[model samples]
Target: MGSVGTRFPTPAVSITKHPATLPRSPIDDDIDKERVAAAVLPQLLDLTAADLTDNAIWRDSLALTGTFRTFFSRELVANTWRHLCKKSTIQELSITAGSAQILRFGPEACWLQASFSFRTQGTFPSVCSGTLGLVPHGYSWKIWLITTILEQPLGFPDVDKLEPGPADTDHPGCLDCIVIGAGLAGLDLAGRLKSMGLSYMVLEKSVEVGDVWSKNRYDSVKMHTSRDYNQLPGLPKTFTKEDYPYYLGSEDLARGFKSYVKTFGINVTTSTRVDAATYDAASKTWTISAEREGTALQMSARHLVLATGSMGTRPVTPSYMNHGKYQGHAMHSICWKNAKPWKGKRGVVIGSANSAHDIIADMVSEGFTSVTLVQRSKTWVLPASTFGALVDPVFNPDTPSEVSDRILLGNPLPIQRLIAMEGIRACADKIPEYFERLEAQGFKTERYGDLWGILCDREGGHFFDVGSGELIAEGKVKVKSNALPLAYTESGLSFEDGTELDADVIVFATGYKGDMKENAKRILGEEVGENLEEFWQCDQEGEIRGAWRDTGHPALWYTGHGYAHARYYSRFLAMRIKADVEGRPIPQWSGSC
Candidate 1:
């Protein structure tokens, strides 16, 4: 696929790049031929009409809230989206046990809504639990520079969605600033900056917004924090018919962001691909470049926000081959947008991480004859049921001011910290069964970070608190199957012990490695003035505040970190950048670049 920018004299890594990509016909408006169809929610659940009624109760994750008009706008947008995809087939991205198998590409009024209830992996946060649904528009406008045919019609190995960013010197696409990956973080940053009258653009590598939700189609995906605590600053809100808030489905989330981007008229070049970038310290500008629809071009931007969050891609095949290959429909959850490919395929999901676990559970619900998650090692697996419908009374958002006077609402950092600590401690005393069952299942544990973490988690596991330390030793989540994955032949997998099992598909849920390209590294280099990779040694956490390095450059800011409060975190980083540009002092997370 063709991408923007100039070629460096000599690049550090040989990035396998794609050239100009293919394009699709703009969807024609046929309101007469097409109309928003009434939605028949997925049949995965035998829900009574009562189940369909709103039940978004319990406290929020973040303290932020939005106007009903905003969220209702999205619902209306979904209505319009329903009009768009009346004939589009609906598929379930994921379907976990005791929860709904989310329907993807469902008909609504203006958009197609993918609705379901998902739980975060391993995270036992008291605040960010519960089930919800969402409706995201279909095919707004995409100028794809990258595409994969592996799962075409439904998905590609990678369909690089183009997004527009800051104005450029010659190429009109580049502008003052460009934010990539318009998920929770990108939209938040873009909207906030636009509100401040900044001339900027957002470049999403997907065909749409909500890449975080779009990318990981695995079942049981949800925020690790409470919904209230994890909203984008300027979006609308839909309260539970009762009172509290909760996590919305992937499509619902995409709708929330789509509204933010559209309502603000954020300049986004969806489906455009950025090839390479070079920093001109002389100009204090980045010579950004990209390719779209078979054309090559370059542009200049004062700043670049690499809000592409943590964990870029999940592989369909494991990095290491245990033996020869056998194939039925082996693919990663990232590549599986619909169930058509795996409808009746028997599957073996390698690795026991959140993605793998979620995929297996979803496939089973989709009527995949049989699914087994091949464990290289067991982990601190916290089922969704534990956190599903969980209600924590300690989080200050729901606490009345009179009772929370000593803890929340503009309290000093010390008081807030004390309350945070006290509430977590109480949770620790209250919830142990979540972990008790895991240990009993023989899933050895590693104290997440340390002892304090155990108490902080109120329970134990990976996604709970979002940080890793040796602090909580309540038996850290352990990987018991450190042994290699066995080999798969024509019909099955064979282990060294001669243990063999039949298989139709073999999926490697082995997570993603950090991959920031030339432009990203060049930005990193300015900090050391020379060695970029060397600097990574000092900062093992990789990108700070997602991708914002502590370099003196303010133009280089990254927001999406794919952690608990990813949407909020991106907003936080963007807020800081907004402050920096407006001559306000920027807060320091870690001064060392």
Candidate 2:
């Protein structure tokens, strides 16, 4: 293995740095961000790994190598650089004009961050973009973190620059792909496919593109995540903060989705519900059966994508004994629109998650005299402000969402979990009473390690407290975790501990069955679905199972979850499908998981 300098001659690279505009803390004032960036660029280009700190992290996604990899520690980074230098040559490198700045999270924590464009000369010349973070170590700065992502192949379609056009409606043969569910995931993939000149169509079951958000959710619902993290790829330039708030409401998000569809000119068929789909291995095609306005329709595609979303469409409501005997007004959280109808009525909300907490808070605000939250299990609660603070370094208003996403998705799941745990602990230390109050009220809180585990395992079972924690702590809202609901009485519910609660309305805030395997089984039949790998949880390799990768069936794919997952993975999924359609070798990494 050869070092970077020995493997390739140094090219004439243009170095440009922009002044940092962020308000600097006293500690950051001593550090010159441009000087640090200029000093670190040459060391990185020369692969002088000794300049990196012992715990530095180097994340490369198909740039230095043809795979996703994270090199931890100075030794690991040096070895990988030497090994890859033998196979690939750095042809050209330059700092992205006006991309260097000092990012300050606090007085004591700040770094010089910059972006660069580079090209790798090998069998396949590839263009890439990377971000570097330099932190002050001792008296000087050291490379603390670097992330590189493949921009495009030498002659491949520049997906970013491709203009939105109408989908291929006149194509008479089987299309390349048919994406189900015209939500964020489906719309994003459609945009990518269209840019790649792939014949694809998006089918939405709802009457409109964003009915899932605007019509289905409860009133007063707002996104827990910030708007930057949730924006889809190829978001229209015209859609600005005026279109959607920092924390989007349901109607605002719906409007944004509508604008995205219109701006991209994506081909979407609305009110189309897919009933069944079967794949033929002989021809490697999928025949889909669907209904639109009671009209049966059939379509054929070489590839079928299940973008119906990770959150299962089927809402799960527990069956209590004698559910129909004494129901005043029983409904699932899905049916909860607003508390206006049940105002001044005694309300009992079952389940202990985001939805349950939000519903309880809404009920209290709506002047409900009595509202009780029945916690069946422990919940990991974190204040919304705390969560925002923890992620502010990456997902702040100043940082571009695309850059923040790469920094986030570059890290493997385990690494992300470990980093997140530190942030959670730090936030908890600042606000210890948040958890103490909830626990004291018998609300059963899991403050640590449970956040990511619950998200991966159940995608629920946790609540980011917006205002509900205070309500519960102050006794404005009641709590019932001592016993489980045993049966329904004429007025309300009876618990196993011989306790009975009187209520006029009972809302089961229990979440949906967010299992992709079960969803596949329902739509694609038992044979294909049962054989597919499990979804959601991290596999042995820490990669999410059965999503954005090959499922058991070659023609089938699942790509849906959060907005960020869709935005980041859609590019890769589209590239994979493009390679398959063009009979090109699909890029694969042989590195260790």
Candidate 3:
């Protein structure tokens, strides 16, 4: 019932059916590995325009969907297939070479990992190689996962191919791993590597572990993620009655990380900053130069782990036309120590993101006479309690942290985004009061596309109302949405809208220059760092493109993010490092890869 050139469409009901019409004669029949590979691999190779519409040819879904994801469900798979069928077209696709390797076999299921090279018509027609995952179904196995190494689908390259350790001879006293940063990501990864019996040391630029949390923090600052989901691997975050049951204070979270250091006895070299790292291709070792207390030091390591986070390392303050002329107090949110000194003074906080709002709240609490928040763009604000009620059911304290992390992360990124959008739609009408307050206070509010899109896609531009939104709603904190500051006067600031506000202190909650490549260049030099990719941005597949994976740069690994990201991915990173150190191939289809 289709046109001459159009491919035949399988019945909608049969879309989920197995290729085989009949069940196998023996329920326990061993899967013929060669037969399944022969049947499925060819389908992957042949890409005709008509085959694009054939439901039986391609998988219903891929394992990765978003900028940061690891798993997918059957329903998501089907939906993703439909989405791709519309967005993509295949002019030509030919398999150059392919081989399937059986990774594991049991009575009911067999795990398959395949490597293939192919040529395509469009884009760059170059050799493409990757690993594909298969599982046995009716008479033959079916394709469930496909990961490419040549051009990573949105997020990152194959875990197995990631170059974690150097290839050359291991010189005497060369440390197995050299981890940069001493915060959560660095500490967590270092601990895992040590447990694997790898000689490792952590370099902390700050004087102590969790320096970001414990030092130079504003009053009443705490983690946005709940404590249960924020705990490090072995140690749980400790909280007091004054703290929110779901969230941990910054100081408390820092203390937990500090405690983890003590319990694990992680080797941390404090006050050490990596000034430069040169990778010697011949020796396959990294000669690193660092400074500790103004004393230059040298260290050599087989592997280098970049745990530097995505948050701006350097604070960004607005460069007002008269910034140099005005004498009012000015500082970025990161440098905010205490607002007590500015008590009884009028303040203007530029930007209305999380940090901006938090700082506004702090200024108010510290007895500022008046505080006006200048928002350059619309922001998505959700009440903290409501946020907890919606997501806490899955990320609550009662369930084991590991269980919650695994189940939540198992779904493909697109599916997770869809579910989040649905949840937001369901709750939209019910949360009128939350929005009404903001609108009543002359604040413009907008819902971010998809539920978690703002958090997943960009670094900033959203606020989860802990208490600031309520204050803004109640008119306790003034708001000036969609306003741009033109210049700074002796008293306050002049806006592009011909409006001026008088203020004693100006706090720019703007943002940091979140370029990981620049950070890489600063530490590794141009020759080496130029080859690295940008970190923390979402790739086409909806997953984060770089970080924590095999970036084309060898012997250099990147890892970061919140508690959950650090906790779950540190293990995978450690496994990759271990495999590289031992000169063993990452076993096929293993979750570690």
Candidate 4:
């Protein structure tokens, strides 16, 4: 499916205008939310295009149009409503009890928002939940944004039944889904599948559930994002504020994963490595071959979910000229546990991404006198304070994760990118000297960081400043970005600019093999992997390619990256798998109107 267009219209008069510029209205507390909801509900239910503003936005997820789409402008929304009303009959519509309220965003933007439920009658009836945001336009309230999402299919278990139950035993026969890996992505999906009462099992190559975080990562690694956004779907209920801080450390996150697994009573088989997976076209089943505790094992399932991780298992290390000639101890960032062993030794970290910055800071804290960070290219840097400011409004301690998730994920990726760039510029304007100082010290930076490109494309060309930026500015940690490394010179690294830095220890903070398709090929054989579409990057429709939905192959799917992606998209993925197992007709995008 293709998106409408990349350009977003900017109107001369917008609902988002500051209150100081617009005419003063009644105070927020004095507004009658019920009256406003009553006045606007009828026009919305009637699907009247005149009730929407010129630049209104309608984000739908298999609710109105039976597809994931974002319609911009009154004309597009009107066309979509015309198309929807022609195909399906609207059976019922009503406001959700106690859902109406006046929502205030920042100092100026105010809207009357409410949640509503509706049903569409057809061969396959769908129950959907939606939120509408209306603003005062001239004499009447007009909708500026409307979001609709599929709650569940008719007669299926409630999607909100996400509580822990007794430990479910592994099925002796064919199961509904078999998930690979027990990391956050896998565990989150498994939890949702359990909530839907689907038969499934999670296989992990490690002996323990959270070993990937506790053992595989660097010792000082902590979540770059805040704690509220990092928790899995149902893990927050078992946590207290004192249990973990704002930013969870690697070990803390690992423990949280263990708690989540125990709380959900999820079926997990540890120490099991999957050797191969093959799909049977005739039977429509996937047979997985593996080894558990040095013994051969095989399992069959109707569907397969590859949730190993966003980044592949192998660490990426580029070969240097005469790398073997250097006698200094060298390793990738993954193998470097802490800086205690390399205390008082001269250390050089090759890479300017998150891991490199983190390792530099760790070495400084551990009393390493001489530490140098080599930057291969320009990196987008944002202060941790700026990052917190961007997310704290939505994903904060005061707000519920589910509520915050909807607001954040509701915007399409293309629109989100534009919004993020604007936010970054606003924050950068407040602290121009921050980037100035780093540039003065020979570190290059991107003016307006491409959050989407860094996240969805390169994945490692950006760094969120925690404390390393300060250390670099203060000259406590040296930086070398003028030249690339030419080769290793027995005791240190030699650069292209005829400069040599002596080092006793060298660490490559370079990232991992991040392509999911390549990882799939290595595990599922070339024949099965080649048939799958590209993964991770965004498609033309502004949706992520080949994740949480179809992968162009029957009996196969992929869960995407990060805690937010895992938490929000897991339920949708589970619903899709259930529909597949039961032979229900799944909705498809019918292209933009």
User: Which candidate should be chosen as best, given TM-score against the real structure?
Assistant: 4
TM-score, prediction 1:
0.54
Clashes of 1: 75
Worst 10 residues of 4 by lDDT: 14-23
Cα lDDT tens digits for candidate 2, 288-346: 99999999999999888888878775689988898877869999998899999988999
If scored against the real structure, what TM-score would every candidate get?
A: 0.54, 0.81, 0.71, 0.87
Q: For residues 95-206, could you state the per-residue lDDT of candidate 4 as single tens digits?
A: 7777778754334445677877778775558897787777777777887667778888887886546786667864868999999989989988988898788899999999
All candidates: CA RMSD (Å): 22.4, 8.4, 13.3, 5.9
Q: Predict model 4's lDDT versus the native.
A: 0.77
Runs in model 4 with CA error above 4 Å? 1-57, 65-67, 72-74, 91-116, 133-144, 170-172, 235-239
Tens digit per residue, CA lDDT, model 1, 272-384:
67776666766657776677676775667667777665344424356434444665555665665654466777766676555554455556657777665556653543333
In model 2, the worst 10-residue window by lDDT is 12-21
In terms of TM-score, which candidate is stronger, 1 or 4?
A: 4
> lDDT of each prediction vs. the true structure?
0.40, 0.74, 0.61, 0.77
Cand. 3 Cα-lDDT: 0.61
Model 4 residue 224 CA deviation (Å) reads: 0.6
What tens-digit string does per-residue lDDT give for candidate 3 at 1-593?
00111111111121112231111122223545445555565654432332222212221112221123332333433444344323332223333243555542112223554554443223222233444556555545555554433222212222222112232233257888899888888877876676566778889988888777878577667766566667665433323234535567677867776767776667788889889987776676878899999999999988888887766577777677987767788778777776788899988888877888778888888899999999888777766765676677876656655556543443334434544554555565567777887988878887433444554556667777777888898898898875688898878888888988988888888887775667778998775566666666544334555566655565787888667767666766776676667765232221211
Mark the regions of model 1 whose C-alpha exceeds 4 Å error after superposition: 1-176, 215-226, 238-247, 295-298, 314-327, 338-340, 383-484, 517-519, 522-549, 552-554, 563-572, 575-593
Candidate 1, position 196, lDDT? 48
- In what order do the candidates fall by lDDT, top score first? 4, 2, 3, 1
Most lDDT-accurate candidate: 4
